[model samples]
Target: MSWSEACHLDRSLLSLEHFFSIPPDYAQTLTGGLTNRCWKIVTTDNKSFVWRPATHITKAFSISRFQEYQILSAIESSHLSPTAIHINDQGLLVDWIEGESLTDSLSFDSLLQTMIKIHDLDTQRLPLAPFNYTARVDHYWMLLSDEHKVPAFAEIYNRWRTAPNLADVGLSLCHFDLAGYNMVKTEQGNKVIDWEYAALADPRLDLTLSIDVMDEKPLEAVYRYCQLRGIEGVDDWVEGVLAWKPRATMMAMLWYLLAYQLWGDEQYLTQAEKLQQAFCS
Candidate 1:
């Protein structure tokens, strides 16, 4: 289902009892996520909580709510994630993590250190499928014909299809979409949020994706992280990781094409053109 339809379904499913036994005194809207509606709830007792209604698309990509509860429960013990309070059949409630997003201002060393800490956490791996950006691009091309997204993307898509084997790379529990927007900078330290796409995958992919969205200084930190991980042949790995961007860009283009169809936004077409040019260049 579409995001709008999923949101309507969420609104229909939510009730006062879903979050708290008693009614909440105040509800504050939180933005950033494209998939779900997030709200900060303040109970009559002055306790703070976060309420998130899962989107239909996200439900396909993420672990079940119960599984998410278990995973978060284990990870929180290491103090890497926020504590999940309750997750019912309809929604989830967790501690409202307060902080700024690690957008442009976060230092490279700080980001790399934070990632290493998360990678070093000893939580048992949860049962989630690996994220294959190549496969996802192929699926998008199959599902939506060249008529949908820019046809030029297919060349980059094919180039990455036969890219070097990353199977020998190290695997760990990764926040699959660890971009600047998802990181929450707390007073104590950085706290990563949005566990929906969290899974066990090549740590290099996460590092690559994170650095792609960071400033030049953080790119250097990414190289440092690679060295500390004993990853030799930095040039080859950088090539492999950089190849991932075209595949990712293709995936984003598919989403925008679909969004444009629904919302009548020509800007989506404009963005897809830009990504297509970047992929080709």
Candidate 2:
């Protein structure tokens, strides 16, 4: 079923009455979600919160609302994320920071700073699950139709699947999706919104995606990141990110391809083709 259909069905299957302490004055569908459904809720007292509806497809996207809740709880004191309020098998609710999304005006340095704070949080005992890179990639690949599965796709997949993960680098709390759409500029400061893809993993993965999305030079971005994080061996870090670039690109390519297959959106197809050609060329 399409996302809209699932959401419509969920509306009938799920109720919002008991989830809240007091009845909300208003609730509306919040856009920008590609796969999941979220609602912006305003209580009688004028408090605003974001409610992410729980769905069965969480497994499909490798998302765990439970994990997200834990991570948010762990980092709540850091003030870099929204405060987690209530969570259950039904859905999740959190305070919605009032601000504009970092869509058109992305501040790369600001994002990096907030991200470093998250990385600096001691999560060694958080019990959050590690992001299994190979498993996630394979899941997306498996979702694609055979017609969309080009030979180069498998070849690239195998190469990256067998390659060694950066074992030398320590794992930290990484927001796998740091795109502008997931960031917001609140009155206090920048706050990252989505934690569906958050995990304990190689910090370089976040850095890799950050640099790619920011369209900044890889080496320069790594240098800046190292400088801010007080991480030495800039050249080595650069090398690690570069080595992981193709793997990251492959994962993005497969995601777009699968998204196109599921939704039949031309934009996803265009992006998938672009990513494919970049590395396949």
Candidate 3:
């Protein structure tokens, strides 16, 4: 039987049926990021939720789906995200939150506050993966070594690598790819979706990774993050996040390339070029 067919038979996997007391009649694919195949599953009675299955997209930074499921299972009570009703090796079922995604001014204070809540979660209960930017950049560069644009990306990153960093780093739960669209502002508050790239790292590092989708500078957010948390060494935090900007930019370019390669769309290639020139020159 196909996966969907098996989903209908397995009571544990078909929690949506149990949750709503109705069987799912159809699942509609939701469009956005190229990393995962997502669906909005609606039951016969109109109850709905998201069913996202992990994909095997190589030449991109490796993502541990198992870790993602673990974090989601742990944070259901935290309310930083939609409650994960069920999770299996295939994926998880979470209520489809209804709200507008944050827009206009790119600096989302609510998103930052939600991030603070996430960072404050006890590390002992929720484990996270190590995030090393240099090593990750080198790995992606190696994967796309033949691509000329990425080499230019690597060269600029080499220059940024010389900057001094803090001797001590504050580690916390980090959503490495915090694209603005990944955040959904519901009645409950700002809930960050997508934990595929979530890990344990310098919270500042996570801030840098998020700048890809933001037009604002890191200084304001960095200062606010420090002030709210009573954190010292404000300049070091800003500098550290700034240093990771190029690496983040490079990772976006790599995703664009992969999108182009997979979909055969010229727009992806064009976007990759625009982002590459913005940083490399």
Candidate 4:
């Protein structure tokens, strides 16, 4: 069914032509969106678009639609992502790239190249900050069942709180969430979506996250980042990332559990349970 048929798009401003110029005739919810409600829109001209509507904040850490648009506008044409055309009360509208996320075999060099592009982009329109690992962890941890608490919490918290977290790491735009969900491999090349969590921070944190999610050796990424940027004395920085790993785990655990709570999806619940066990062990 068309966008008009599936839902009540009662305003002319919300019409397909208003956004895409071509009338879109079909709309279906896309799978694996995980964070927001995304719909695949097929236009009468045969072009495809993604329609994502606003949802309430799921976790307490950080995600701002307005910030996403600002950063995106800065780098929209850098070929790192799809083109952004418009933003309405409904949500932002951008050209939808057809591709798969870079999950495995995320070549070190390729990943570094992408990171370089992001770090090099002119970002005068935005303000960014260091990764608030502690706040995010605390927020997510509060969502978990008390009985499932990790025994190492106090030990981990005290040491992590005092350690150097690279808070002063040079500020630059970073796609903070480098997990596969934000990546897509199209015929055009690799592209990252979901700008809601992008911010300015230590580019190294992006590197550390890339290592964590891609299941690659941390030293490999740290070494490459150092080589590319001509930096040194990252031992403390690397240690900061390692210290924050448990919180990363907690973030995942809470996301999955919350997914289960909201959608009653058993897969998410199962994954949450597994992560809880892993963290406590």
Candidate 5:
């Protein structure tokens, strides 16, 4: 069953008997998700699952449910992410990882190791799609309104759109969002959620995004990642990540700008303005 039919704002569940043989006896809305609506469901049999319903803005944010399923399946044996139990046009259902959010508790070393493991995974057999940077950014830019499209934004877009895509090298399955908040420390281990932005891309891009989200220095993190992975010339890789830093920032700015236009959230606009100011200055 879809979100509209299965869930209600009154915290009541509808006919979920067909969705999961034994309808869930309990359901709770999980807040703090910026992109989609999420619910934690428990069936009479005591099985728990997290349900993320598809929305009109899923594509607007460059998320691919199909790719998410494939990536999860490819890495299921590694136990780095949740198991994708089921997916349809409506939404995705996965095993509920029972653990507290480890945003503050998770160490940088642990986070870096997780990134290494994900990069080392064998994804050759999976039909994973590459993250086309230009196309994706162009789509986001087009979604912005005229008033929001200032000359500064146009210049930033032109610079990044023409710059070389540093992420085209050393391709691997990269979790675009490796922030501590996206991870949960379970009894089994740290399990990462939100595979919507995951794709086959440069490992450096993953490292850059992770360090930036954690508010750590990019140069130091790059050096650590290179040392752990054992690369010959560390300087070159550092340069690549440094160059990708602004590009990553640009992508976030465009996304926030577009989100502001669609959702009319003042916070989103503020974030967009902050990024623009930082980039322009």
Candidate 6:
């Protein structure tokens, strides 16, 4: 069912006979994410599942859905991800992971270590695309306007394009978006969710992105994390991380701008301006 239709179903008011025969009676509502609507449903049997109704735009949303399913299936056994229960011709449904987001509670040291472990995972058994940060950044730059944001974007983009390869830097699977909001602190440890933008790329890109989202002592956290991973010559890695900041910021700005245009919310535009300021500065 579409997300809107699912949200309108009330478990308390409606008899279980009206809807599709799932074991339990449930209620759903639009929750999480800025683009797609997610419905959280609890069955009468006490089983829970999340229903993500597909968004109309095929380029971003649809492609992301397909990519997420592919990546999750490829990495399901790494012990670092959520279980993708089922995806079919209709929609995507997965087990609802319950836990607190690691956004505020995560230490920089721990996060960096987690990232290293993630990047170090063996990928020979899985078929996935290679991560080319330079190419991805170029894609974002192409979408940017030449008048207001071109020069600033080009400056940062060039640095990442030609960044030197560091020792022990190996390309492996990467969770492109590893922000606190996407991480869940479960009983087993931290489980990463929201795999839409994952790729096989430089591990440093993940570190850089996470550093951008860190509110407390970002640089210190990054350095410590690098050290723990036995990553030598951290100064070079730091440069790479800094070089990646503008591209990441601009990409986010573009997303927010697009979201604003689609949803017609001035707040998105405001947030985009703020991101631009950060990028330019």
> What TM-score would every model get versus the actual structure?
0.79, 0.90, 0.80, 0.78, 0.92, 0.78
lDDT of 3 at 162: 33
lDDT of 1 by residue, 1-281 (tens): 33234335457235436445666666766787755567777767888777766555445333355666666877876676779988776667788878887866777667677777777776454555555655555554565545664447556556655434653555677776666677788887788787765666667667766776673433465578877766667765566566555555556666555555445669867876776677657
Candidate 3 lDDT over residue span 85-144, tens digit each: 666555667778787776443355656676788888877777665677667655555555
Off by over 4 Å in 3: 1-22, 58-61, 103-107, 145-165
| Full-model lDDT, candidate 2 | 0.79
As for model 6, its CA RMSD to the true structure in angstroms is 4.9
Q: Score each candidate by Cα lDDT.
A: 0.64, 0.79, 0.68, 0.65, 0.80, 0.64
lDDT of 3 at 239: 78
The 10 consecutive residues of candidate 5 with the worst lDDT sum are 8-17
Candidate 2 segments exceeding 4 Å error: 1-15, 163-167
Instruction: For candidate 3, list the clashing residue pairs, or say none.
Output: none
Give a tens-digit lDDT track for model 5, residues 111-138.
9988888888887967966777888889
Clashes of 5: 0
Name the candidate that leads on TM-score: 5
* Alpha carbon lDDT at 128, candidate 4: 48
**Could you tell me the lDDT of residue 200 within candidate 2?**
89
Off by over 4 Å in 4: 8-22, 57-62, 99-101, 127-131, 141-164, 179-181, 186-188
User: How well does candidate 5 match the true structure in TM-score terms?
Assistant: 0.92
> Candidate 6 regions off by >4 Å?
1-24, 61-63, 132-168, 216-219
Show the colliding residue pairs in model 2: none
